[model samples]
Target: MTTLRTLTACFLTFLLSLAAAVAGKPNIILVMSDDQGWGDVAFREHPVLKTPHLDKMAAESLVLEQAYASAPVCSPSRASILTGRTPNRSTCYRHGHSMHPKEETLPQILKKYGYATGHFGKWHLGTLYKNSPVNPTAAGYDEWISAPNFFDIDPTLSNKGVATQYKGDSSEITMRLALDFIKRQSAAKQPFFTTVWYGSPHDPHKALDRDKVGYEKLGQHKANFLGEITELDRTVGELRAALRELGIEKETIVWFCSDNGGLKNLGVTGGRAHKGTVYEGGLRVPSIIEWPGKVKAGISKLPTNGSDMLPTVLELAGIEHQPKHPLDGVSIAKTVLGQEKAQPHPLGFWHYDVAGIGCWGEREMQALLKLQQAGQEVTDPKQLRSSGKPVKVSTKANSYPGHSAWLDYPWKLHRIESKKGKVSWELYNLALDPMESKNLTSEKKAEFEALKQAHLNWLQSVQTSMKGADYE
Candidate 1:
């Protein structure tokens, strides 16, 4: 006969076991390359760039052919991916702007569920100095080894806000740091979320000696650029192999993408506008999602962008929260899991680089490096920011505009607001003219008008959020 005490003990044990199961969610690894264009991959027909690992991963995963970045710049796109909202919603107006302190981030959300979250490599969303209010830790990462912007060989990084020097290929160094964090978390039986942002293939591209040799046919600059991508691809292979060797391949969610489009002068943007433009070349990127346990090998052309990352990850982890702020992105968990065929909503892209923000991230990082070289502790928070006061955006005069687009598959509408406040619209049937060679505005007046109205409504919503309405 079972005693009453034994029955109570059994019930408690069952409850504890259930809690562990809930906390042991899939490990998430998000890897993004710097300035790697859609055509910069071997599988995508890059004449010189070699990406064997990425090609293999693409074959085994669900590839997104229509993947886009929220913005055509690095900082804004990174903010959108982390917050599941457009960069404007968080006031990340341009390349140097820091992430808003008030906004919730992906790492913070995962932390609520007992996940060990770490950010490694380029953290252009904000300054990575020890005391910056917008540092990775302030943005919800438990621990971070990061740089304020794009870095290269022999780069200086902040290891949990401490300036440290590392020597290696930048891509490989970033991955190794992330892998260390993953190994520690796995050994402790804790699920983890890590972002590995590689600072390769960006400007000042300096590929290692071994990586640049094969690209001799191209010019020196092109060779170096393509070589950096080749190095990045090798690093990808290393990360995947490490995960499999650790026996967590099936239980991990790995995603690979580029922050934005390729360089305009490279002639490698797949026949579209390059980075910083709202055209296909500037926005479109190579993306692959691999979850051996849940998602099958396939391909998707449904339009998606960086803003969808956080929501999709949250849903995948089964964490439910009703956000007070309206989300610009919708979760595509069902699509990834093979339960849905198409994304249910169209994506919006806007680019308005607000000037005169006076971002001090570069200055702060340089100072930190100097202090480190002098063997001084980088503990002064004031040194990490542009101003001594916490960074804040003025909510006045929200009517600023630049280029905005409404992308709804088969059709796209672009609204360009000139500096003089003159507005012009262009319409393109993407299916018929993927190159956007012909404007359909005069022929498809009805469709153009409808998309124009839709874009206007979206602009109003975005501006409202920008004016601090979202927090309320």
Candidate 2:
């Protein structure tokens, strides 16, 4: 009788602990748009575009007014989001570089805690076919419908490992796939992490006819570009509405942002130069997080970045496992909850001057699909979108080439290294000069010297990481 009583109590305790853990795990959905800028959304005073749904989110959620992408490009920023580290640490030096399989990914860690994870839309990290190391599945996502790069309308996406055709607007198609995953997970009462990476507002601005409704007056190019953004807004509304209808609105956390800053004329960067530069115009992006239960609605100018996503989500989910490698992003959970003002440390960004592997969307996918259906195999390494042979990354302590920047709050320092070995420095107090008009290196000698030394130390650490010291 005593043994029976003990067993009963133990079982009850187990059940209660399980329930508590489940309650703490929120349904996390990270939605990213490719190449959309800080001023692309309607709420940011965009003159022509109308993003009602996103505006609603901005009004009701925690808006990070000064959020930046880890890099000024797509794949590198995605790497930061996946691993909570900078791009080069994960071997993503350029736009189409593959994320290293050795790195610990967010989906992999979340899955250990029984979360159903799915990645949908533009997965520019690597090939979608099973062979690539950083393919969505290999990167730890349980389910994925992704593209090699930026897919467009009626995109031919890789379903699991098979290339398949998906119709409708690009952004909507991506959102619908995520919604399906959310519904299934909700039905099973399982926590989920779904990434709805929209492939719109990137290039070749192909917007649906209906979405082009109010933008006809703006030339054809502008109309199409704005329409793509409008389409994105509608999809955002759809995702939020679906969650509410499913009775899980308060239990979900939806984070929305763009991959990089805007283009020259088509979009607004909200800063100096457009995409590809280390300037605010290239790195600044629209970012918002909506969590009705824990995080209250408010505006915060706390500087955040893509590297912060993984650690932040882990903190929110109460997962305490540390990454086996160095992480550039620290948990900004307090910031999201309006308890913290800024990051604990400065953020680092580098535009590594390496060539990116080119992978087209429809053209390459359609060809791969035909090859797969014909029972043929892709044997060539170039055809497979990877070198196949092992390539060693350079890890010299003094080889910090290209443009790199360090943001330590109101002060930002830029290091420009020319191909001819000429090195120059530019310092700007972003709080005073958002456009980086004046060079304050001469005036702020103390700050300039400190930041330069800090950047050098960081660069050396990054070289160590590149040498596979982190994996060791």
Candidate 3:
């Protein structure tokens, strides 16, 4: 009788522990690379620019082949990921725009559910020292070590609000800070939400001498650029190893992706155009999600976008509250878990008003540079106006009359209104031609018209969001 009682007690204890483990929420680690391209990874078959670590990550994780950034620029894409909304909806239509304090960020929402949040690397959303209500901490991160923009080697990062200098490669430094935070969180047995956004391979490209040594024979510029990416990959490996060392590998969900497209001048190892355009080579980036025990290891050609990350993380963490504003992205948890046969969201949208050399036009870039140089910050839309009305800016697209695209199902309809007011449409069956080389617009007139209307509707919705109407 005594033996039976002891056996029963042991069985009950094991069951309870199993239940507790199942009930425990997983930690989230969102790793974003600056100006990385979809073709950067070796697994993606880039002719050059080897990314062994990223390739390994893709092989051991869920790789989303058709993932896109929220915008062609950095800040807007980051905002969309943080807020679970489109760039326009979040009032982050362009680069250097800070996220509003009222917006609920992924870290903030997770914090409410007892997750300790840390943001390391680029925090281009707002100034580090400024008493702005729209700062990263105000947006819901408990601990923040960030740069105002894409930082170079040995960049100075603001810890909380105080500036501190960091040595070595930028990406490695960022990872070190994140690792320290992770160690602390792990020791405390607290779940953590960490964003390790590396400022690497962005322009004025600089890499450590040792890192560049391997590719020294190549052109100085090309060597430095590729070196930064290679170093960034090593940092990722370190972070993964650290997680395993802490015995949290199985309990942590690590998501790796890029902020925008790769740089073309730096040798477009990714696709076509580099950062700053709406082309597939510019907006589409590599994305991998790794969650041991939960997410199965494999490649998912499913299309995922930046806006989808927030919702996906929230759902994975079992958080219930959805933002009052509608989301452009849906939870990709099902796809990550290998439970879904297709992507959660059908269409990924990319829109930008500013036009110039890169994604924005030269005139727009000059204006922005002037403002930054003068230290005259433009935080609010009202501040953009000289008078009472909002400042109106035109783009090359505007000169072309109007340009719009609707990526519906497997078809992408591109409507180009020429300067002569001639409306020309082009259609490409993306399912068959991912490169969008073939134009079937004339043959698919009815389909093109339907998609044009859909694109217009989407534009109207985006416009309303930009005006902050949706938030109200």
Candidate 4:
């Protein structure tokens, strides 16, 4: 009887511990749109486009009025979000750059805590082919349905490792796959972390007929663009409804944002410049987080960036693991949960412009697809051909050129250097000049000089990390 009692007690304890773990972990869904602008949503009062579903999400979410992507482009910003470091720190200097395999990613960190991780949709960080060092699976995803870059109608996506085609609007197709994954995980009573990256509203402007008819007056291109956004908005609605249906609505965190700035001349630029530029319009994106039970629905203007996402996820999930390197992002858990109103550090952004490893283009993708179709053996050529090596940045450069900015709330500073060694400084009080129309460097000499030094110090730190100092 004594032995039986001891075994029974042990079994009960194990069950309770498992229950506690499941109760504490939240289902995290991060949904990002490619090239969707800050002003693209109806809630932002865009003159033409309407996004009813996203507007509803904004109304219920903890919206960030001044959220920025770590970089002005897609791949670098995605790398920043995954690694909690700025693009320069990882040498993900521009679009199409693959993250170094050595870097620890968010999915890898969460996996230690028993989260079933999955990635769906666009994966520009690297190739989606099987065994690619930078593929979603290699980066720590347990399951993934993704494309090498932005994929469109009848998209060819790699499901785990096999390339398959899907019908319907790209946004809807991506969300359906994510929802299926979420549903399966929920049914199995497992916590999940899913990334749904939509390729819509990026280029070539192909939208569903049902979504485009309402915007016919805007011209074919504009109509298609806006229609794609509407499709994306619909997917957001479906995701929220699915979570509610799964009885986990209050226990999930739904975060939404654009990968980068809007395309130029579509009149959706949120600030001074568009897309590849480092201006406010290029970097600032519409962002929101809906954590039903924890975060109160509200708005905040505290400066935040893509690098902050990983740290924030770790903090919220109660996971503790030190990275092998430094992180640029500060956790915003307190702010999101209505406990704090400001961030601990200033946001820094830079465009190094120097290319890293070249992208896995159409040719490689075709070869992989043919192999999959033939039911033959498939392996990632890029990962097999190259060594998983750390990047080394030079420490003795006289000066770093290109655009780098230090954003400390209303005080924004820009350091622009030309290849000819001509350097210029520009400053703006964002409170007064949201458009960055006037340069305040001449007027605020003291502020300009101080911020310049701050920017330089930050640049040096990033450069040190790039040289693999953090790994030591």
Model 3 stretches with alpha carbons more than 4 Å out: 1-23, 267-272, 355-404, 415-424
Pairwise TM-score winner, candidates 3 and 4 = 4
Which tens-of-lDDT digit does each residue in 1-472 have in candidate 3? Answer: 9999999999999877745543588999999998887776667775566677787888888888778887777888898999888776666656776665567788878876778899998877755543456667777888988877777766666677555667777888899999999999999988889999988777777888777766777888988888888899889889888989999999999999999887776545333356776556667888889988888887777767788899888888777775877788788877788776774345545455443222222233244446555866555543222122222333223232344466665787766665466776678887777767788978888887788778767766766666656657
lDDT of 4 by residue, 253-302 (tens): 99999988888988487799898888899998989999887878788988
lDDT per residue (tens digit) for residues 207-281 in model 1: 888998888887888888888999999999999999999999988999999999889777367446899899999
What would the TM-scores of all predictions be?
0.92, 0.94, 0.83, 0.92
Candidate 4 similarity to native, TM-score? 0.92
In model 4, which runs have C-alpha deviations exceeding 4 angstroms? 1-22, 355-364, 375-385, 389-395
Lowest-sum lDDT 10-residue window in model 2? 385-394
**Residue 438 of model 4, lDDT score:** 98
What local lDDT score does residue 212 receive in model 1, on the 0 to 100 scale? 83
321 in model 4: Cα distance from truth in Å?
A: 3.3
Q: What are the RMSDs of all candidates, in order?
A: 3.8, 3.0, 8.2, 3.1
TM-score top scorer: 2
Please give the range of 10 consecutive residues that has the lowest summed lDDT in model 1.
387-396
Worst 10 residues of 3 by lDDT: 382-391
User: How many clashing residue pairs are found in candidate 3?
Assistant: 6
Q: Give per-residue lDDT, candidate 2, residue 362.
A: 82
